[model samples]
Target: MDPDSVSTDNILLPRNIEIIDSKIVNLSIILFISGYISKVEISKFSHFRELYLLYIPYKFKLLLRGSRDGFTPRKFHESCDNVSNTLTFIKVKGTEEIVGGYNPLRWESSSSWGKTNDSFIFSLKNNDINNAIISDIENSTYALNYYSRNGPRFGNDINIENPNSQNENYNRIFCKKHHYKKKIRDSEEDFSIEDYEVFQIIKC
Candidate 1:
């Protein structure tokens, strides 16, 4: 299995939805709110910034995991069934909507990917499923860059990440409610979903 780098040959007009809540602190009430702090009513601070290919892996994994119960891979894909393959779980709706990019401006690739996730599977025995997951991530991301329409070529833009931006208000509240309780600051470990002891926000 050959790992492909970001393809420079195509029209890499890659855009990302980019969410803020880097980690869940309290219950979903407040989130970390990536990039900047909120100045307004926190709840109304919803801003979506369109970033080019930056630390995409970091941003993407954070955004992906933040929505999970505890950022666990299984939690990310609820549609996975107990399959007989070497890799038991699969990303059921992994391809759908690419969702949230519903803005009438950019081209939506997520919808197409969601449609493809069903067919995309990596058998651990055949090609190292973990590796495949990584590959798929890259492939999916790279594929996003190629999508071009209406001469302008838009990326699947959406509101996420920034709190002050008119789009990610809810996310800001989610971050403040979920700040890392331990405050164990180390350069090596920033403490992600796995570090958080509690799964559900309120232990209902």
Candidate 2:
């Protein structure tokens, strides 16, 4: 079936939401957070199409397996479900905040991506690239570390809880574990979210 010919009637959109742009590409994801929404254009980046095609064959097989299988953590295991080597866009509530990161490797429950030190995270307001704050990640462990959880810890953003700090909104892309553990430790910085959406990054 032609993508352009597909109907979006089944696609859920919140009431009272303004349509930003009607132009549609191969993969356009509209993420709604607290009634506000943002779009992620798959064609804007690079190399997403090739990766997505690679997933198609596997996806057919996965569907077959799922028919026989009873359960799986499909939501949490984004990469395992076929969104490998993708960028996750997270939109948070308040101050037009957005925070997200890229996972360069496929997520597997058995391997945990094997100490991927190259992974990174970034922050932006109103989806403005000029106002973006890109940070190289120091750690990329699961939200749980058996003893202590570790994810992307930002600067001045304390991992430990502090009553005095005012930045209470926690916007993080946690992998396979709890979102409350790993933190971005920038006190002066704040990217809090009420909710978010995850899309498979595919470059056109």
Candidate 3:
């Protein structure tokens, strides 16, 4: 069978593979290659999708890639500001951990706090979906922080500090327990990221 010619809609899995939930499985595979970054896997993305609780099917449209687009606050805002319903995926450097947040409100260059109860932060384990951890917003008023000089900040919990140098270590991306219900990362110390991607969630 020609792999490239096989359409996602009618593609068939091996007969030996068990079909527990076909819809979720299919959606996972389709969305994984649909312009989303390579760090997030099918199962992990599927779990993230379930967290949204949207009635209609949605697709992730890549808005910005930190490595490809540049890891600066100015660059982030230029590409992502004004775009609503964005899902960010950050690959932690030197670890199998992938942490991110979902903002239902539009990102802005002006400084302000975005209020929305639908926002959430999460950590996905690369090998297992069951190990994923999701932290819901405890305070809607501080759900998201939009600043002209910083990357995405989820209520001071998961903050991607504006890069000041070319070295990844100076980026200082960190996660701490704050407005969210719980901490997504095991530690509250600052860390660096391998790469990150922001996607606009579009309902179809």
Task: List the RMSD of every prediction in angstroms.
Answer: 21.8, 13.1, 9.5
lDDT of 1 by residue, 88-187 (tens): 1211122211111101112232223211111111111122212221112222332221111110011222111222332221221111111112111112
Q: Give the per-residue Cα lDDT of candidate 1 at 168.
A: 25
For model 3, how does the per-residue alpha-carbon lDDT over 154-192 read when each residue is reduced to its tens digit?
A: 888988765463232226678998899988888888888
Report the error of model 3 at residue 146, Å. Answer: 0.8
Candidate with more favorable, higher TM-score: 2 or 3: 3
Q: Write the per-residue lDDT of candidate 2 for residues 1-204, one digit (tens) a residue.
A: 787785533444345533222111012222211011122233432344333223322111121111132112332343233434444444454546656554555444342333455555555666555455545445445321211121222222222112232233233322221232233323334434344333343332
Residue 51 of model 1, lDDT score: 20
| CA lDDT, every model vs. true structure | 0.20, 0.34, 0.69
**Model 1, 137: alpha-carbon shift in Å?**
13
C-alpha RMSD between model 3 and the true structure: 9.5
The numbered model that scores best in lDDT is 3
Ranking by lDDT: 3, 2, 1
Off by over 4 Å in 2: 1-74, 78-82, 110-113, 139-185, 188-192
| For model 2, the run of ten residues with the poorest summed lDDT | 58-67
- Model 2 residue 68 lDDT score: 33
Which is superior by lDDT, 1 or 2? 2
Q: Tell me the lDDT of candidate 3.
A: 0.69
